[model samples]
Target: MLKLGVNIDHVATLRQARYRGREQGEPDPVRAARICEEAGAHGITCHLREDRRHIVDRDVFALRRTVRTRLNLEMANTPEIVAIALQVKPDIVCIVPERREEVTTEGGLDVVAQEPALTETRRRMNDAGIEVSLFIAPDPPQIEAAARVGAQFVELHTGRFAEAFGDPAQREEELNRLVEGARLAHRLGLRVNAGHGLNYENVRWLHRVPHLVELNIGHSIISRAVFTGLARAVRDMLDAMAGYTGGMPGAA
Candidate 1:
């Protein structure tokens, strides 16, 4: 079964719009995590971004205490966040690239470029007995670099493929790249996961991807929650993804 790591950063984003710094109110991310778990979400993912634009320190601590399912902390490979991760010790730490300006994570981290630093970071987290995963592009070089850096898993960045959605030729090409990337990563013995811009519709086609164990989705699910409520939103997504485990029905 494909695990759904529900991202609640946007829930905090909605809260931050009016709650001021650290104030509690309506769209509480902590409560959201609890709701998600009760609804059968495999995990709760939240990025404690550098800018504090969305998820913040308090939220991470709350989640660490409240999240019954796995608490995956999406962070950047920076000293502050790294220290926080070590002290808090979430179940999984996914290192993603960040820019203060971008509305969301624009793309994956360049593991090859940051190998030395990333390796050290991974070592620290591993020493703490915390599993580490790198959010990276679906490229062989990046995957190999991640493995070399001692990452237990590599989360394939699906932004390019998601952006290509609805365009037959481009979508096929990008999907092929993801398929090949997953094959190479799996061959290297790294567990595989993917996310970014995935939703109810685009996720179905991912039944073709091999060796994928988890998908971290946010914006789409959160947006859908506005209409259907949180529990149904998660169950609905799991229902949508249930058909994917056996591999694509007829894809070559």
Candidate 2:
């Protein structure tokens, strides 16, 4: 069965909008995580960006103590963040690309291009007993590089597939990339996961990607939580992803 990793990064995003100077709050990411866990989410995800933008150090630290399920920390490979990750020791570490100018992660990490830097960073995280994953576009070179760098998993970026939303031809083309990428990575023995732009609508079709073990979704679920409540929103997603293993990752 595929697992659902609910990302609570945007909960902190809302909180940060008000408390730019310090930690003051109404919407708490930790609390949001608790609700997601109670609702049967297999894991909790948070991306502690370099700019201190969205999820902060305080939140990750608190989540370390509070999250009952697995804590998958998405981060960039930098000395400061890697240091914090080692100290925090989250269950899983997914290295993603980051740019200060972009509103959100614009694309996946070019693991093929940055293999040297990622090689060392992956070593540090793995040495700390944390399973490492690389967030890369579903391209062969990047996926191949991830294994060479010693990452245990690779999160296939689905942004392009998602952007093709209503266009059938574009969606099918992007889906082919993901299917082929996941198949190749799986053959290499890399545990595969996918994220970025996965939600109620598009997520159902993701079951089509072979060998996807987990889906780390954030914005869409959080946005739906505004109307349906977090628990129900999670359940709805769970319901949407019912039978994802038979040539499709999720059920109707």
Candidate 3:
């Protein structure tokens, strides 16, 4: 089944905006995870950035304890974060590129250049019985590097496709890239999951890319929750994801 992993990082972002140094805060990420799971989210995802701009160590530990479903931890491949991930023991970890200045993840992790470090991290996580995924752009080289690092999954970055959605020609080109990327990753024995810039409207177009196990979405759902409530927001995305036949239509 196509699963939805609700990212509650922004919930913590909201809390930290008002209660950064305080011990207590509103809009707890753990509570958000609970609500998302209750509303039929297949998993909860949170990024513990090195800067601690949003989701903090305490919140990750709490989610590790409280999240009933799966907990997919998104982290940079830094030693500090790797150590914390080992202690937290999240179900899966998607190693991603990080920058202090960028407001968010601006691009995919360069698995090709960082293959040695990523391979070591993947081994450690596998040793701890944690599945490892590489958050990479839908490119053949990166996907191959992910397989080389022995990652169990590759989360194809859909930011480009989402950015191109307004133009039919560009959207089709990006969609074809994603379709081909998914096919290559699957053939290399890697499970596929995609995210970034997926929203209620654009997500439905992803059926053309085959072998998608889940989509980890955040900003759009949380923004929608501001008006429609979190549960409704989640259900609406699920509704959008429904009826995916997983056929690679028009894929070369």
Candidate 4:
């Protein structure tokens, strides 16, 4: 099965929004994770941003102690977060780009441009025995740079592919690039995972990408939960991946 790493950031976002004026059950991300586990999520992903925007330090520690499945920590390459990661030591850590102004993760980390800094961060995280994944684009240079930095995994950002869903030609082109990138990464001995902007409509679009072991989905699944419930929403997406019949876009 294609593993599903459910991102509970939006769950925290909702609670934070409500906490602006009212309070309820504290709206813990760990609790939301348990709900995801019970709903059949293969793993849990949380980003501990510099701003404490959504998931916080406490949430990361709590998940490390609580979750039965793997925990993938999303963070930027900063001394503070890197130090915290050394102490918490989740199953996996994905390094990403961070900006105080952006509403959310707007794009993939420019690993090619920041190779030296990224290389050092990757070394520290790997030495601590935590799997390091680079959240990069489907560009060949970025993919190559990730491997050179000694990262064991690379998560291709699917924001472009998802946005292109409206235009068949654009969507097909983006999917093809991702498919090729995944194949190339796997050949270089790196685990390939994809996420961001992926929804029910484009869930199975990357099945043709070789060696794709996991997909981390957030906003779309959580939003759909408001209508279909979390478990059903997750299960429905899993079912789509398992039932994919067209041999993916570039399965040649």
lDDT of each: 0.91, 0.91, 0.94, 0.86
lDDT of 4 by residue, 146-201 (tens): 98998999999999999998999999999888988888898788899999998887
What's the count of clashing pairs in each model shown?
0, 6, 0, 0
> Global lDDT for candidate 2?
0.91
Number of clashes found in candidate 3: 0
Write the residue-wise lDDT of candidate 2 on 121-197 in tens digits: 88888888999999999999988998899899999999999999789999999999999999989888899999999
Which lDDT tens digits does candidate 1 get at residues 56-124?
888899899988889999999999999999989999999999998899999889998999999999999
lDDT of 3 by residue, 1-252 (tens): 689999999999999999998888989888899999999999999999999999999999999999999999999999899999999999999999999999888789999999999999999999999999999999999999999999999999999999999999999999999999999999999999999999999998998889999999999999999999999999999999987767456522
Q: Which residue pairs does candidate 3 place in steric collision? A: none
Top candidate when judged by TM-score against the true structure = 3
lDDT score of residue 197 within candidate 3: 94
Error of 2 at 125 (Å): 1.0
